[model samples]
Target: MASPTTAPARDASREALTDSPPVDGARAPGRRARMPLRGHLRELRTRSLWVAVGLAVGALLGWALYDPLLALLTRPLHLAASTEHRDIALNFTALGAPLDIRLKVSLFLAVLVTCPWWLYQVWAFITPGLTARERRYAVGFLGAAVPLFLGGGALAWWVLPHAVNILASFAPEGTSQLVNAQDYLTFVMRLVLAFGVAFVAPVLLVALNLAGVVRHEPLARGWRWAVLAAFVFAAVMTPTPDALTMVLVAAPICALYFAALGVAVWHDRQVDVRV
Candidate 1:
């Protein structure tokens, strides 16, 4: 019933219809690639499985090195007690406490040992969505983050002895400074982990800068806020409530924040030049 003059238009419409994808099975052209909820859940499971494997391997390593690591952790206690001519050491009030401590230590050590691997697994999962340039920045971020974390842990380790000495010096004359094993270990681990995470946070800020999500001007103008945050983090995280120890904790982080700011500024300049 179509007019003869519209025959070419009808033919072209039919051809286009034939070339078009099926509505039930295909996404529209120019739509961004997005995974369904089911796909996201599957990806999460896969990443979790690999992370568990890394933790298991790290646990084994922790078990193998338990004795030496225990000694290393107890060094500050030894130094403090020995200086006071006392043999006061970590004590447990319950029967199964030793086993509990071992399990705790193993778990914590596993987290520390497998951190980079687990982080890489996380990155690998998210990388498919990122551009090549974004991937490069992410890898650079991971690299910078790992070393800074280790360095922060090292700083915590160094600070612990001084902090211990300061606390012990406050003990009343002729009394031993007894400590609960579980509490001491928990405190020590939290301090190290806190410092480690704090150091890593600045890397995220720098990464954002590199991604053009944040500018150097705001970051530079917010130095006071950063310093305040550093002090608050230190006050909350450090085991003891000493001003000196808090200062020690905050000082390095503030310095690192400035360093990160400098790097981000330079990187923004480079990006501007490129643009």
Candidate 2:
């Protein structure tokens, strides 16, 4: 019923209404402007708060499980005592040492238990800058890293008793070991943490290769150094007098490094093909 000119004007008005800029001032429907520094700080603050909350809750759980955890950690000392036929005591010189060690162990357990959550938070914070392919790589990195680290920690536990036995054997015919509780705890933690971190180091190499930060050829060429480093690391971490225990620890690390190297070579080839 309207005139042609009036119909055209109506269409124009509708088009204007539909195509007008958003009230929020977004340039396009699905696009957003870069967040300001304050926004990023706020986001970081929120994520950090959640991480702290997770740690606190995990620490509570660790406290509840402290008895079993302590028992497990001290098993190496017990084994050493039995095998060496000597008195091995973990002495606490300070009155507050017990409470301090408990708190420290609980915190360590909390960090281990809540690692996946905190790692995801870290990944999430950096994800905006990554492409989809990079995101997939990140996910795979997390999945592989966590298990490898845990496995390495388990291996360290298995190796502990032998290392303890060997070291304890070095004592004179009648001397008993009076180890400080804090010192022993620190040693155990460092050994376990070192093994875990060492296992994860290969995964980092793969990540670097994926990011094109390092080439596979260099890794291949450095095989001898890798072997040497693996032995040196085993020597430092395990402190065994014989080659057998050191080899047992070093073998897995060497295998993992070569495995990671293979992965890098394969990935580099694929990238070459794609290019």
Candidate 3:
């Protein structure tokens, strides 16, 4: 019923209305992809299964290397024994202590040994949520995490003898120091794990920066507090009263925090320039 020119105008108006952004400048909604609940549950099961398999393999390998690992763990005790000239050796009070210690140690060692594989599984699970830039950052984080974790363990090894010596000093001059095998090994394993987590924590701070959850200024300004907290954390967690061991543990963490802050600042600069 309309004329040709009027019909064209009507079509143009309709197209404009459909094509325009929303009133508040928000983008028009598009069809979003969705996954069913069953699919999500299946994905979680697959990832969890892979991680469990990796842990099992690592634990098996650790159990296989039990003799060498035992020697490695006993060295600090030996060193302290030598310093005191007490000929002290680790003793098991319970019948099943030896086997139980190995099992527990293997479980802890599995986390360290299978780190890369389990970390990849985590990355894969989250890959859908990450942008390309975030993926690249993730690669860097993984690279840094492994070495930092190993370094922390090595530092713990160095600190252990000192810690053992300090703790032994508390005994009276003539008392025989019989170290409990289970308790000592558990303490040592937990110490290493704590240090490993502490070392890798800076990676998380950098991640927050990259994700724009935090900025560099606040982190940099918080340096004094970071240093105090680091020392306090080290003192509480090290199981040693020696200031040297606490400082050794705290110093690297502070260094890593500043280093991560520098990276965040660089990233922010690049973004500002791009903008």
lDDT (Cα, tens digit) per residue for candidate 3, span 9-72: 9989998887665443243332211456687678878999999999999999999998899998
Best-matching candidate per TM-score:
2
RMSD (Cα, Å) for all candidates, in order, is 6.9, 5.6, 6.6
What TM-score does each of the candidates earn? Answer: 0.75, 0.84, 0.78
**Model 2 residue 206 distance off true place after TM-score fit, in angstroms:** 1.4
> Candidate 1, which segments miss by more than 4 Å at Cα?
1-37, 211-213, 224-251, 267-275
For model 1, the run of ten residues with the poorest summed lDDT: 24-33
* Local accuracy of candidate 2 as per-residue lDDT tens digits, 4-114: 899889899998886775553223332113677787888789889989999999999989999999988888899999988999878898999999989988999999999
* Candidate 2 global CA lDDT score: 0.87
The backbone clash count of each candidate, in order, is 0, 0, 0
Reference-based lDDT, each prediction: 0.83, 0.87, 0.83
1 or 3, greater by TM-score: 3
Leading candidate by lDDT: 2
| Poorest lDDT segment (10 consecutive residues) of candidate 3 | 24-33
Off by over 4 Å in 3: 1-35, 233-248, 270-275
